[model samples]
Target: MITEQAPGKLYIAGEYGVLEPDCPAILVAVNQFIRVSITKTNSAAGIIHSRQYSQDSIHWVRRGFKMVIDNRDNPFEYILAAISYTERFCLEQHVKMKLYDLHINSDLDSSDGKKYGLGSSAAVTVATVKAILRFYNVPFSNELVYKLSAISHYSVQGNGSAGDIAASVYGGWIAYQTFDKNWLKQELNHKTLSEVVSEAWPGLKIQLLTPPVGLNLMIGWSQQPASTSRLVDETNANKAALNGEYQQFIDFSRQCVLEMINGFENKDIHLIQKQIRVNRQLLRHFARINQIAIEIPRLSKLINIAESCGGAAKTSGAGNGDCGIVIADAQTDVTALEQEWRQNGIMPLDLHVHQSKIKQ
Candidate 1:
């Protein structure tokens, strides 16, 4: 039997700007996760099972009906996608494999009426690619797995930088640069880019706060589904209008990132909190990527609530109906905030900044 797991993630900085197709973004791996465990049956058929989800069946076969998400579509489709892609690649490259039973699972509980956002999705991809490689006894670098996972995600989720994928896989505070589409090559080696911009200081501490009661952490649905296709279209349409704004926002992010780094290095809680608030505002201005307002009033209210408690808050993903991130003092009473959110039907999470391992 083969089992695998990966951590969910949050895009702490850089969302819309990475769409330039040239620039890179930064993300962090939160504590949430998606795990997979599987054992191949010698019955000439590959089965897929997700205990987290009460659905299981023959997902792939050697000669019978082909396994596909549309047929076995569960939360594990992304994982299978990576597996399928890797399998095909391995076949083409003649990578050998042994048959084994497979079981897939995830610690992320989005179906529990809790919203951890897309971090689980990224985690699935990371874990899937890793599992597949291990099952085949293939020797691949972490960078290679990250790239493969990114490619698999792009195949299904349209356009997304491997930045979040990188953070989830590498587990650290990384400065991501542009990635090459060729999974064999592109890696998030932001240290090189940082050296290019080395004048921006070095030590930066990014603190993520998860309220105990889940108050102040809300996911607005926009009450309307915004498909990736439509969002990408609008993004392309706004290109001309966004060029200068993008540059300005990037500059703002860079500067604020510097301040954050300095504050973290100096251990200045007041300065870090203030700069986080400022960065949150700047990111919000750049992230309004939709036509309908995603309950800005509610979001604003939450921000105000957090601010009143001596913390900072902002939208975590591509806004217009996504998760919000809060930065609070280490000693802030998160339970009180969580209680408030629970009353409002919102559940908060304890986001973690995972340690990064750079084996150069």
Candidate 2:
């Protein structure tokens, strides 16, 4: 059996702002992960299983580089894309490929089956890419895995900076600048997937960072699932109307990204806290200016509670409701904050920075 796992991530800074080309963001891998299990199969058939899907399994026949499914609803479309694209990479390198039974599971949810907005799809895509490459005995590096995951994920979603995908593939914390996703997607249309996979990705940037010493962190989930896609679409629709405000927001967001990297590099808590506060305020301003609820009642309460507890906190992802990040020293009484979170029906996750990249 060939098994690969990729961790989910938290956006430290530059959430909405990273969408712009060449803009940077910071992300950290969390302990939760999407795990894929694979075993070679006979009879030229491929089986893919995922509990999150409606049908839970895709029974398909593999003919050369194509996969044919008889079902109406395609649950493993992203997985299929990864396999097809990886096959392309192999074709260029002259590697052998075979059919396999793949089972994917994730630890990114509450015990009650609630998602914590941990970028499960990105993690799954990263894991699938690595697993497929391994099945073919193809030599791959972390950079190769990151590239394949980025392309495979973009092939499905079309949007996203893919900071989540990079965090999943490279692990630890990273300062990430996304490639031009639209440019890469255009290649999928103009050329074969194999040909595209063989070329280098233009404008991709990923740099790993070491966390500051003596830093304490906490994450609280509001138990609300936010569709990042919907949020980005709605926000993008208003970008033209709020051009001035958008530019201001992006500038400050880029500053926060730099400050975050500076803090990690210098091991300076003051810099980290300052950037956290400023970034939160900027997001609040953006929310009000654009008429989008980037921070909700519950998340606002969480931030307030963290501030009162001597920690700086902010909404992590596309906001509205998902999870928030809290930063403080080890001496702070997070016990009280956790209790308060539970009282408000928020779940405090026992999540920490996952240090390793994708593992087999």
Candidate 3:
């Protein structure tokens, strides 16, 4: 049996800017993870099961030149995609593989199984790809696994920045630069999955980051799941409705990111504080332009409490819901703030910064 797991992630900064195809975003892997376990099976067919998915096992078999999956709408779509891509990559390289049963599980959600928007799909994709590669004894770099996982994720999700995928693969603080989607889309028009995996991704870039010394970090969940894609769609629609408006927003977002990165690296506390607040305002501007309620009531309350405690809080992901990160000084009364959050039905996750990436 072979088992692998990858951690979920949160973006510290640079959420929307990374979508520009070549911008860098800072993010971190959290302690919660999605775990995938694989064991050899005597039967010709293999089964895929997930605790978070349906109870029944999904049956699959490899034909002479293709992998045939029985269920197309299985909850483990990303996992299945990972399997297919890895299998295809092996076939392209002429590597032999064996049949196995794969079981998937995760800790990125609550006891009742509600997601906290910790990028579960990305974690699942990374874990599945890693497990599949090892099942066939394929030599892999974490970078390769990341590229493979991003390919799989993009195939299903379409036009994602893959920051979540990067975080899952690397398992640490990262100032990640998104790959060129235009180039990728063009390449996909002519290249096979195997060729894409093996070819040198000329313009792809990634870098690990370190937070400033003595930085205090906190995360709060609104318990409201936001549809990241829907918010993205709304923002995109607004951007398209007005010419040059998107560029203006992009300019602000880019500056916000620059200040954030430089501020953290230079250990400039005031700069960091200013940028955090500036970014939050820009995010609010984005929501207003798109006419979407990104800052839900709970999140607004969270921001108020954190600000009252001498910190800054904002929507962390695609906005509208999910988690909000609170940046505060060490002396901030986090205990009291947490009590207030609980009173308001918000959950504070005690997730520490992850300094490691994927592990054996």
Candidate achieving the largest lDDT = 2
Best of the two (1, 3) by lDDT: 3
Q: Is candidate 2 or 3 superior in TM-score?
A: 3
Query: How close is every model to the real structure, measured as TM-score?
Result: 0.72, 0.89, 0.90
lDDT of 1 by residue, 168-249 (tens): 7777545555443443223323323212222222222223232222222222222222223234446667767767876777
Which model scores highest in TM-score? 3
| Candidate 1: segments with Cα more than 4 A from true spot | 21-26, 51-77, 97-101, 111-115, 180-233, 262-271, 287-295, 350-360
Q: Global CA lDDT of candidate 3, please?
A: 0.80
Candidate 3 per-residue lDDT, tens place, 95-180, comes to: 87778999988888777767789998888889999898888888888878988999888887665689989888887777777887
Clashing pairs for model 3 are: 170-357, 171-356, 171-357, 294-320
Reference-based lDDT, residue 355, model 2: 87
Off by over 4 Å in 3: 55-75, 200-203, 357-360
Clashing residue pairs in candidate 2 are none
